[model samples]
Target: MERARKPTALATTPGLPPQPQVTLTDSNARLTATLPTGESIDILLHGATILSWKDAAGRENFWLSDAAKLDGSGAARGGIPIVFPVFGTSDGHGAEKLPQHGFARNSRWEFLGKSTSEAAKEGVKLDFGLSSQNLSDDVRAQWPYTFGLLYSVTLDRGSLNTTLVVTNDGDVPFEFQTLLHNYFRVDDIEKVTVKGFEDAPYVDKADQFKTKTQAGAVTFAGETDSVYTPAQGPGHPLVIEEDGKPRFRIVRDNLEDAVVFNPWVDKARSMGDFEPKDGWKKMLCVEPGSVSKWQTLEKGDAFEAAQTIYLV
Candidate 1:
């Protein structure tokens, strides 16, 4: 009797539409979403941190430090790092034991799944999840609280949107802060100017966190670290311009504060992970989040915020 022939695999079966171009690479540590127009984004599971975002012209939109550690040893120095639980150092409330910026930026998150939308604009959304049960022993012991985080990253034709939902799964209330630390790539720092915080009061972190009102559009002349809050009113969309040309437009929802930071010369060199020594001159950070004050989440409650960056 003749043996049965083996089946052959075809690249495209019949006449069905081709599947979306999304993949998980780098040993499943990274997820990439690509559009038909050649725009794409790369997200690392280490922090759900967006490592790269390229436009149709293959130009990078975010700056990743040359010396950034990609081995999951520590937080990456660049890209969009998610800050949660606490921002910078723990202020108080039995959270002094927690590490600066909490564990969100260093913890490994679960790749929840992916979805697609074709409403007003075609887009792909990748979801990541992290919870109390997934934390390391050390992180759990620091500020014990049952919480769950669902982070969604959406990429469209000319924009990227990131939304974070924090849920309290414990019986008691907990206080926390969250921010999307964005390191925007620029041709030169001297030509970059941030618009929208003209009259908003900001706390200058470089000068002992003293409160000061912005005189006009923010410009970097030296080391700058300021947290602009909604003192006057809720924030509007902010535009990042280079030599009077808009580069990126940032729109925030439910995120009440914005942070502008540049380590400059001494601080840049002081950071062991910031490579090239002068990388500061090529990058500017205009971050949006709910960080000026802590948000209280009661048991079974949830809070959500989002930020969208449009390429101009």
Candidate 2:
């Protein structure tokens, strides 16, 4: 995979804080980042999944299910899971009929090391690599496309940044989907209001693939699953408002679609992996993705998608 610049010196970031120290520990199974402030981020190498991200005040911006399995058997039930090559079960669109959300989140990834950027000095970055060359025979046979993935997780002053860089190393072009299945923290599913998607067109996955236009800000009252497009508001972040105040702000770049979902009651109870029947009340998935359009990459071509999150 194409490598980023070597870790650079901390550049002057007027609004950002001091740079953090990044380390790989837990027997090379996890990477922990400690910022100058009291905040920290933990990334598990298993799936290149973010296990935890705490703000300066030690408040968590992510929600990991209480019943989540952390034994490295598969992807954890929470935090932010990267869905690539495909977002979900095939409903058409030539998506690889592989596992739900694909193997990126289920298979282990190589720790490709970390780097720093002069543009963002207060931030510390960790990188993980995955490729068809490292996949199990079963997975390779299912979707025989040679690809390289470089996933980066960063924590700076007061923001969390996750970036995915995909490279097509195969001879023929391949079609795929990519997304950040972000499970954000919430006090009440009923009181939390989401913005940036108003007036956007979406595919109501909960309603038989029905296409509809968003009438207003989104709220969770029942089962909610919709794929929104052009989610980039004119100049605004996707804000999560609670008790009439903003709490989480998310921004995505190089990604066209955004999916917001909450299984609510019945659906939440149906998944064995998700513990606590009422866990739906504590989390909301506002996924930034390239789902509405199938991204086709030719030989040696690459694509990158990134999301930055701030706790307000």
lDDT of every model, 2 decimals: 0.89, 0.84
**Judged by TM-score, which candidate is best?**
1
Could you tell me every candidate's TM-score relative to the true structure?
Answer: 0.93, 0.89
- Give the Å error, residue 170, model 2: 1.9
The TM-score that candidate 2 achieves is 0.89
Residue by residue across 1-312, what tens digits does model 2's lDDT show?
766877778978688555677888878888888877777888877778887888878888788887776667878878888898888867655555588998888888998776664346766787889999989999888788899999988777778888899999989888889999999878788999998887899999899999999878887779999999844542357888987899888888887788999999999999888777888998899988888778999999999889888887
305, model 2: CA deviation in Å?
1.4
lDDT of residue 115 for candidate 1: 82
